[model samples]
Target: MTTADTPPRTLPSTSDNQLLADAGEGTRVEFRGLVKDYGTTRVLHGLDLDIAPGEFVSLLGPSGCGKTTALRVLAGLEAATEGSVRLGDVDVSRVPTNRRDIGMVFQSYSLFPHLRVLDNVSFGLRRRGMRKKDAARRATDALDLVGLDHLAERFPHQLSGGQQQRVALARALVTEPRVLLLDEPLSALDAKVRVQLRDEIRRIQLRLGITTVFVTHDQEEALAVSDRIAVMERGRIEQVGTPEDLYLRPASATVAAFVGVSSVVPGLAAGDRVEVWGRSLPLHTPGLNGDVEVFLRPENVLLVAPDGPSGIDATVQESTFMGNFRRTLVRTADGALVRVQHAASDHLEYAEGVRIELAVVPVAARARTATA
Candidate 1:
């Protein structure tokens, strides 16, 4: 449902200030066999998720994936076609958006254009029959938490986009939601502002000990902010783990391809061992045989002088100097382009056509070749 259309949700007797300050132990969230369909098009195919109290989770995926739809379901903005959503022990699957006791921040920073920042933040409280004076006071406290108290008197039009988003965040937190849902909340901000605001959001979430579900298509953003990420593909969660789990040990080829800079090289797999680039290596992915492709991140490939017993012969094709790191493109004798990442100051002379040796770290993911 649209922000303007959200049903009246106000706790008349409870002071927003007291509620916020004493926000009870963050509530756990559970999604059991959740499913959503648009006519014949199924968007979520029996999804299951469990979020611990005060845990930070990010639903990460590409566009058209079900991450945002899952968040909307949690917020009670969209009814699940099947399954159940429980907040703590209470099933909120059929709960109205206003009664779900959750707060959401959108990419657009939906602050009312007509109201000052303080009033926009206190709007929810005042609707609950809170005294105007009490709402304003609580709003100021919320603003202060977001580091926007000084901008309380300014209308949304008078503030910067980042400031407006901060106001929206304050508004969300002022209610002390049991669960915070962020739907691409930083997508509209500039790179710098997005980074700054995400950092701020993480800091505040940690300090408040609130359970949060952040939805984003940006892998880097998810990695930076989330304690764990659920990577969605098509209508299902491909994998769910800590940022490092999904990055270093992706459970599927789809996740390996999506999470980071991965280089897929043709190889032969036999049980626990795989041979790639004329060298034998360990395969971490199970149930792979015959011809396969081994995937490894650039950091896992080590470059050295070809004179040693450990290095595979390769020629430098290109090199790009990124701050703090250097990315070099090297082609193997088999015409495979392998990238080597190292310290920018390492000074591995990588001129075009320069012969070099690559020692690949043993751990890699193996995807079975499809027989057509």
Candidate 2:
């Protein structure tokens, strides 16, 4: 079985291990009314988010959404045009990046090409005026935490992309910063390596209990590892919630479309329910009573007999065989494309006529008159 198929390893409860014990408790991180601009263009628009101590929060959005700009402001890399960043109770908006007591890992593994892995990991500590012997010992512990102690003597070019990123991670943690910032650190690695390293990063974060802020455009990556996610669009946060909350109860149509796959079909809203494709389903949230657009998840759509008594008639357009499930796209009589997921065993060929039913689950929606 592949690593994805295997169950994740359970983390230990106690922090008696050397690396865990050294990490201590995390500090609170807050971004208050953060705003950023580049000369004439504004990138961040009065952004406000608060991350609790030791919680893993992901800033998830598409490109040009200002997620990276928010991170840079928090990191002291870019000055916020109009707000302050607080670590615990202290405002560090004016503090230099080096003095903020935070560790960061970037997309590119910015390791020293000439230095050995051990020296690369220990470089930050030595620069802080720590004795060489103590810095080396701490670096060894940090390397062991990421399971790369065996490659201490290798140079950057000698290691694989994943290993080099791990070295960067080790180097980031060696200083025991109060907060850990990850900026799409897994994007450069291959799919399998990305999964492995992301899982490893989550495991290490859990063990260390470090306050972490991860920025990623990959919804799956954010949903898989975050305690909470803040979805941003056009330099503004649309919603913030847990993975389940975001997926099941999106606040807006944009969130419904972004958090996961959703088919936007026209519907008529009554008191507490919406009628889509002749089927009445409960609304995820109340307060809509007019023509509306319903968001239907693939899993909520089911394929049934073509002659079924009550269902929408659609022609299969495409089918993709996932590991255990098959996702099929079908075009409805009204010319709307809908994606339906079903067991792999029940396959449908292209152009095959079929009837699709929406499961009686609460669905998110927005008024038809509302802006798209």
Compared with the true structure, all predictions reach lDDT values of 0.86, 0.85
lDDT (10s digit) by residue, model 1, range 74-123: 99989999999999999999889999988899998888899999999999
Q: What is the C-alpha RMSD of each candidate to the true structure, in Å?
A: 6.4, 2.6
Per-residue C-alpha lDDT of model 2 across residues 202-313, encoded as one tens digit per residue:
9899889899999999999999999999999999999999999899888877898899898877788898778887777777656778887777888888777666766777
TM-scores, in order shown? 0.90, 0.92
Question: Could you tell me which residue pairs clash in candidate 2?
Answer: none
Report the Cα lDDT for residue 266, model 1: 81
How close to the true structure is residue 325 of candidate 1, measured as C-alpha lDDT? 91
| Full-model lDDT, candidate 2 | 0.85
